[model samples]
Target chain A: GAGVSQSPSNKVTEKGKDVELRCDPISGHTALYWYRQSLGQGLEFLIYFQGNSAPDKSGLPSDRFSAERTGGSVSTLTIQRTQQEDSAVYLCASSPRQYQETQYFGPGTRLLVL
Target chain B: GESVGLHLPTLSVQEGDNSIINCAYSNSASDYFIWYKQESGKGPQFIIDIRSNMDKRQGQRVTVLLNKTVKHLSLQIAATQPGDSAVYFCAETAPLNAGNMLTFGGGTRLMVKP
Candidate 1:
């Protein structure tokens, strides 16, 4: 079966620019999540989407960070006015359903804000 | 204010040897815990999970042990092989208004010597 997939495996941008990272969950997954990982650090939760409910933006660090999942399938994470501190690997994961413990992940999109 | 952390940042073991990775989490309210394996340039891949009600769970050559009393979690691999070499992370699910979000620990890098 096809696993989760992400686009633009690597991205380099200048500070103050905006970038979008894309994620495609498995065929039937109903839940998607985005996280950020700094070098040699743990993953920091960004946002989550389940079914048609409002996305969870609690983990988002600031208003500049936003995400959208359309048709309950694909998700895009956008960081506006990126800062050097925002340089990290953006990862996406998905589960078969809400509250499911196991999450399948995609190869992350590494973002470097210079 | 809750956080998850690992005692060791790196571990080296010979092939065929058993490996143990330890993690500590501060959120007692967490009910579900998971372990993930990630290689360079890749996102995390789920290994196994255990609920707070269970003290231990096993899958294939891997075992996850949780000690709620001490808020400790450990992943043990029996007869580990070179393929097991990677960064291992322990994550706990924190309840959110929208659902459960994972809080990950700083990963422990495992180097397997053939």
Candidate 2:
């Protein structure tokens, strides 16, 4: 079985540019989540999707950050205007259910804004 | 501080010695806890998890102890090795009604010396 995977393992862009990171969660998983990892920042919850219900957008960093999960499987996180402070690893995780289950993570996409 | 933090930012131990990493979470409603490990260039990997109902849970060689009385959680690694050198993070899920939001700790860097 293939584990969770993300495209463009690494990405680099200039400041003020737009960037999108993709995540493919495990098949049959009903819950998916996005998180960011920065130096000394630990892991910050970004957004979460469960089945086809409304997504939880509370953890999004700011207005510039947004994410959408289509078909309850693949998710795309977009940044309107990239900033140097946005340079970090974008991680995606999924689980069979959101009821006290463990989350399996993808390799993550490292984004660097210059 | 109102965030999850570690007593020590870093811990150094011999390859065969046991290791203990501590975390303090301020949220009294945090009941579900999980321990994750992140390598230098990889995404975080889930090691183990424990609910507030139980005070202890054990994995292959790792153990998680939750002290709800004091809002403290700790991860213990037995027979530590170089392979275990990485940043360990403690994450807690909010009480039942808060959805899937997880608050993560600052993390503790574990250095295993040969």
Task: Report the lDDT tens digits of candidate 2 across residue range B1-114.
Answer: 246778888999999999999999888877788899988888889999999899999999999999998999999999999999999999888755235667788889999999
Superposition error at A46 for model 2 (Å): 1.0
Across residues A1-114, which tens digit of lDDT does each residue of candidate 2 receive?
578999789999999999999999999999999999886669888889999988888888899999999988899999989999999999999989896778888999999999
Report how far off residue A75 is in candidate 2 (Å): 0.5
Candidate 1 Cα outliers beyond 4 Å, as residue runs = B96-98
Alpha carbon deviation, residue B107, candidate 2 (Å): 0.7
The best candidate in terms of DockQ: 1
Model 1 DockQ vs. reference: 0.74
* Chain B: TM-scores of all predictions: 0.96, 0.94
Q: How do the residues B37-100 of candidate 1 rate in per-residue lDDT, one tens digit apiece?
A: 9998899999999999899999999999999999999999999999999999999885542456
| Model 1, CA-based lDDT | 0.91
